[model samples]
Target: MGLRKRAAATVVTLIAAFLLPLAAQAPAQAAATAWTPGISPLHDGEWVMRDIPGGDQADSWLKNCARASGIACVSVGQGDGKQSIFHLYKCGTRSLSNFIDALSVLNNQTGGAEVRFTGPNVGTYRAPANPNVIWKFPNAATYDFNTMSVC
Candidate 1:
């Protein structure tokens, strides 16, 4: 092959080598950042969900929510208590934090608003507003949640 062609080929190869990894990481990076807690609140009511990292943190948050009044809180995953907690105070579709293991959902909206969980394949689960109640879903980690709705 001619030198010019060889040089151009080398440039193309180098560019691809540099860009491919970035392209591959783009989705993963977005996914990582998208899972940030306290990022999106869908509704105009008091709703909270904690993305717990470990069983220990889950236990702690559950106890805390039990004592809190007039606020709905949900907890997901058995994480290290590093993920942010979600807050919703309206009636709309709310984005969810990263799921590690397990889940707890609470609906504390006034006028009997309901909280709904939608998964791509697992369908939807709805919980009505119940004060001082925590809806625990231990198998929530297996489902891929698309959006959470409160109405």
Candidate 2:
């Protein structure tokens, strides 16, 4: 091949080598931004739950939810006296519903901690002491839940 053609080919190859990785990374960067908590409205199926009682049990629940493939993001914050706050974002309806189910199970297994949730489309739910009882929020998009002390 001619030297000019070779040089052009080399330049094109170098450009592709430099730009391809960046193009591949663009989606990941966008996904990271999309998952950022509280930056966007919850209308896009994002959700947050706060005030979950902190302890071994809460930790287990958080871990389980984080492991779930449907969950997009999970954030936990510490509070006074083993209490905690949790924010779950970019969750599908099925995943969030399943999470609530699991949380009810956890509540019952933990001897009935009062779990309260607050958010858009979701009303405040105060879980009773019965294991069979589950709070129902049909239209809830985003919510926060915490364990309330029963005194």
Candidate 3:
């Protein structure tokens, strides 16, 4: 009889022991799984600039502005202090594809400011905040801006 009681007690104890860990862990597990906010870098209204070659005399100044501001000078129409367009690094190394995506995004967000990859460098653009729009050909051919131009 005593042996039977001991066996039953052992089984119950084992079950209780296993369940205790799970029961204790439930609240802790829930807390750990919950997400805590504010882990990412906040860049609201903040931007960086970069200069890509191809723009005429103005290119140098834009490059300087980007360098001075401790950002990047990725391409043209970026560094001019007059426009104050907010630019940023590609979060990492820049690739041609990434630049294309960036250009598309910038052009889309900034109200479709004529996003011209400069004809001068088919790889560059004369992008700005607004008011100025010019597409330059590799031969320095420029498509003058009128009212119907893009950003």
**Winner of 1 and 2 under lDDT:** 1
Q: What is the C-alpha RMSD of each candidate to the true structure, in Å?
A: 8.2, 12.7, 17.1
lDDT of each residue in 18-74, candidate 2, tens digit only: 999999999877654322122223445434555455456555555554453333223
How many clashes does each candidate structure show, in the order listed? 16, 6, 21
- In model 3, the runs with Cα more than 4 Å from the true position are 39-151
Which digits, one per residue and each the tens of the lDDT, describe model 1 over residues 1-151? Answer: 9999999999999999999999999887755643434326545545455445546666566556545444556666433444334445556687665654456666666787887877787888777887666666546532566678766
> Local distance difference test, per candidate?
0.61, 0.40, 0.34
Candidates sorted on TM-score, descending: 1, 2, 3
lDDT, model 1: 0.61
| Model 2 CA lDDT for position 22 | 99
TM-score of each: 0.54, 0.35, 0.26
Model 1 misplaced regions, further than 4 Å:
1-70, 81-84, 140-142
